[model samples]
Target: EKAEALGVPAGPERSRLVRGESVTLADGRIVHPDDVLGEPVPGAKLVYVGDASRVDDLVEEARGADVLVVEATYLEAEADLARKYGHLTAAQAATLAREAQVRQLYLTHISRRYSEREVLAEAEPIFPHTVVAKDFDRVRVVKQQ
Candidate 1:
C-alpha cells in the first residue's frame, strides 16, 4: 500500500523496492530499504513430522518454524503404549512444538480411543497454539507486523 500510495510504478522499480533495495519514485522521492521488510508480508515456514517417537534433534531441526505438524497417537495415560508403538503422545508433540519455538502446532494421526478434544487438552497447556489436525485441514500462519 505504501508503494502504491507513493506512486511507485508497478514494474522494475517496485520489484527493486520489494527486494529491500532503494528505488527513486516517479516523483523523485527516494524510499529507503527496511531490514525487516518495508511491507508487512512475510514468507512462511512449515515443518511436518510423521510417526515420531524419537525427538532428540527434532527441536534444532524445527527451529523458527511457522507451523509444525506431528503425530500424537495416544494420550499421556498411554505413554508406554506410545513409546512401544513408536508414536508420540499429545503432551510430547506439544512439548516438541514449544521447545522448537514454532508459531503453531497441529497434532495428527491420533488413536481412535481418544477424541480430538482429549488430544487438544493434553497439548494446549504445554503449547497454546496446539490444534487437533483434521483431514484436509489447511493452516495459514501470518506474522504480525
Candidate 2:
C-alpha cells in the first residue's frame, strides 16, 4: 500500500517506467513525464533544474513544468564568460524557459558580480514569468489547468 500511495507498482519491481504507461496515485493523480521512466512526480509540483549550463538538453524534459529552476550565472553582457565556465546568462535562461513553455522560471546560482535587479532586467523581457531567486525566498508552484 505504501508503494501504491507513492504511485509505484506493487511487487519486486515496485516501479518501472514503460512507454505510454502512467502511474496512478491512490488519490487518482497520474504521474508521467514527456520522456523516460522514473521522472519526478507528475500532477504534483515539479521542479526542473538545468544546473550550471547546457540547459539546451533540458528543453523537452522541462516542457509543461510548474517551475524551472536554472542557473543564471552571469548577465547577458558577459555571455562569453558564462560560456567559458559552462554556465548560462540571465537572457539564455529566460530563452530556455520560453522555449520549454514552462509556467514559471526561477533563476538561481547567480554569480556574485550581478545584482538581483540586473538579472531580472535582463530576463523579464524575454520571459515575463522569470524571477531571480534569493536566499530563503518562498515560491508557490501551482498546477496549470
Candidate 3:
C-alpha cells in the first residue's frame, strides 16, 4: 500500500540489496538491513548504508536526504559504553547529519536511561535543529526560513 503510493515497483528484487556485491537495481529498490531496495519517483533513488563496518556506505547513502532519521542512543559522556552497544552518541549523530548536509534530523531509538529533557539537552547542542522523538508523536519536516 505504501509502495503503491510511493510508486515503488513490487517484487523480490526490491526487497533488499546485497552488500559487498555490486548490484544494478532499477530505480525504487528498497534496501533492507542486508538487501537494497527503492521506491519509484522518476529520477529519485534510495540507497542503503549498513553498520559501522560499512560506515563509508552509510555516509554515501545519506548524501542528499531532505531529512535524516538517525539514532543517538547515548551521550558523549558514555562514549565507551555507546561503542559497546553499537550505538551513536548525540555528538556522533549530529556530525553525520552535518556531514551529509541533511536539511533536518529526527532522532529516535533513544535509550530509556535518560529522561526526555536530558535527551533534548544533550542533542540540541550538537545539532541545532535536533528533536528527541516521543512515542506516538508526529512531526512534519519543515524548512528553516
> Which candidate leads the pack in lDDT?
1
Tens-digit lDDT string for candidate 3 (2-106): 434444456543343322333343674443423333343343233222223113346667766666777777777887877887777766776776777666667
Q: In candidate 1, which residue ranges exceed 4 Å CA deviation?
A: 1-42, 141-145
Evaluate model 1: give its TM-score.
0.68
Local error of candidate 2 at residue 118 (angstroms): 0.7
For candidate 1, write residues 1-145 as lDDT tens digits: 7767667777888788767789876678787656224546457878899988867679998887888899999999999999998999999989999999999998899999999888888999999998888999877776533
Model 2, residue 90: C-alpha shift (Å)? 0.6
Better by lDDT, candidate 3 or 1? 1
Q: After superposition, how far is residue 54 of candidate 3 from its true place, in Å?
A: 8.6
- Model 2, residue 105: what's the lDDT? 89
- Per-candidate TM equals 0.68, 0.68, 0.56
Write down the RMSD of all candidates, one decimal each: 5.4, 8.8, 11.2
lDDT of 3 at 62: 76
Better candidate by lDDT, 2 or 3: 2
Model 2 gets an lDDT of: 0.77
Model 2, 73-124: lDDT tens digits are: 9898888888888889899889889998988889999989888989999999
Judged by lDDT against the true structure, how good is candidate 3? Answer: 0.60
